[model samples]
Target: MDLLRYVAFTDDPSGGNPAGVVLDAEHLDEPTMQATAAEVGFSETAFVVPRGGGRLDVRYFSPLAEVPFCGHATIATAVAHAHRHGVGELLLNTLAGEIAVSTSASPDGTVGATLVSVPPRTEPLADGDLAELLAALRWSAADLDPELPPRVAYAGAWHPVVAAATRARLAELDYDYDALATLMQRHGWTTVDLVHRESPTLFHARNPFPPGGVVEDPATGAAAAALGGYLRELGLAPAVLTVHQGYDLGRPSTITVTIPQAPGTGIAVTGTAVPYES
Candidate 1:
């Protein structure tokens, strides 16, 4: 029943996205898990139920509600598992799908985890929905990137992939939290994946998860995996991708996304993690 805190996607605990990692939740119920997650007050708290057959049932809960999947929490959980059992592979049954997680130890004694996401799909943004979303964020059509269309992408969870034409535009993140949260709740979206592509392989990203009661997420590996799928689906990229996030928050974290052009193959997101002192 111990609650461990760890930050994923950065070797330094103070750098990456913080997540509550509970390695064993065998004796906990849904209510208790939710309360625990709320008490932890992270964007997401992962509860790992170690079942038989070398598989663990993973559930993610934010301070407000449950989510389909959470990448930072998954990375934190994998690192916690490695700290106890050693670096290796793990089978996780999440609300989204079956995720395969592999862990490796770095030279600096940091534990990293790579999780393959479910096959991704995208849908055109509804006209009305787009208007509402723009209003919620106070962003107009001119503020978007013509190269990256506004569409809803799904890897494990659904996210609106909105690309800013300029870095300055992405940095000025002022939005109505309640309005966005309402819209996201109605659409079942995990977050809005705000992105700015710097080059062919490098990119910057920010995730606004108002529905989860968070202003912005520093690092979002799941959203990066979904972005990789979206890019490949739209013929934006053919191979691997690198996502740089949290720079705006001053706690930069890197997420490497591996893309394969299979019909229904999962996307892999890799990042390093470390335990939090406080």
Candidate 2:
């Protein structure tokens, strides 16, 4: 099996989240896939088994366990497929649901991919859960932004949307790993989507991914989609919004989230990717 490495959400190899891609994993079993992902040691690794007719069965595995879906790995896989097979549309069968991905190239020859998530939904964060979450993150209730209330959002995976009132609060991310992991595991949360709205059309984000056995994720596609859904559902989203993430991690990445006017629809996330030698 050929293991490919690529960074999603940025054209530069050193500026985005790295993912492992196995484009042809037709014979690998679950144990092998899990071991491979663990060995790869990125946030997630994508294993694809072609089903023909532009359809593929895709599985995402992190170092510790398998996940329903992964945004950055999906982008990396799509871009890798485009480089090898050609840019077009693909129907991905994931554990979460069927995801539609499209690949295109820019004038400067950068390959980009856009994945439309499954219909997103949100649930109010229970008061008890909120207290536990804040305690784990070492954040106080007063640090939260009133405009963007806390919610558990789901696009393909579940994420708790926690909005910081100020950028400074968002930057200070020293959370208790074990406590947060336990809380997230109990709630079945994929990540804690910590965000700060810079403007109507721009935002800053940081994701705590203890569930994935990682301290944080630089550019989280799944959480971004969930956040878009949360904003749209709350009537706070613009038609187009830009998310700046990974700045504090020093691997700055950009994610573009597009919210359709119609309610109860999928959200679109677009970003460029590049192959990296690993």
Candidate 3:
């Protein structure tokens, strides 16, 4: 029942998103896991139960509830396992689906993990839902990017992909927390992926995660994967892309996404993780 803390997407411990990792939680039940996650007080915590033969059963829990999948926690868990065991591939069974993760150590001895999300898909955002969501965020249709249309995307979890027309719009994030949470709950969305495309291969993002009882997520892997899927589906992705997030919060994070040419395949998200002191 050792609770390990690690920050994902940054080598600096204080820069990325912090996640609680229980490497071995074979005996803990759902209630205990939920309580432990709440006690950790991070955006999300990962509970890993070894199923033997390089396979692990993983569960993700936010402070308030259990989520189907979590990208940052998954990255943290993989890095933690690599530190304790060794760098290699792991098969993770999550509520969303099976995810494949590979861990490696760089020349500088930095541990990095790349996770291949389950096959991703996208659905159109209904006009009514879009109006309500914009109202919640205090944003109008004019604020949205004309190129990247609004859509509900899913990799391991669901996220509404909203692209801001300008970087300034993305930077100024003052949203109705309660209203956004209610809208997200109604749509079963894990987070609202607010993004602004800087270049063809570069982007900046912010994630509002009120459904998880958090105002915002510093780095969101699942949402990034979903965004990749949405881009690939629309023929807007250029093989690989970099997403910079958490800068507004002073905890900068970098996420790299690899898009496959094949249709209906998993998206790969890679990032580094380190032991967190705070």
- Model 3: what TM-score? 0.99
Query: For model 3, what is the alpha-carbon lDDT of residue 123?
Result: 99
Q: Which runs in model 1 stand beyond 4 Å of their true positions?
A: none
RMSD of 1: 1.1
> What are the Cα lDDT values of the candidates?
0.90, 0.95, 0.96
Task: Encode model 1's per-residue lDDT on 169-261: one tens digit a residue.
Answer: 889989989999999999999999999988878889989999888999999988998899889888887588889899989888999999988
lDDT of 3 by residue, 157-203 (tens): 99999999999999999999999999999889999999999999999
1-278: candidate 2 lDDT, tens digit per residue: 99999999999888889999999999999999999999998999999999998899999999988999999999999999999999999999999999999999999999999999999999999999999999999999999999889999999999999999999999999999999999999989998999999999999999998888989998999999998999999999999999999999988899999999788899999999998644
TM-score of 1: 0.97
Clashes of 1: 0
Clash pairs of candidate 1?
none
Name the TM-score of candidate 2.
0.99
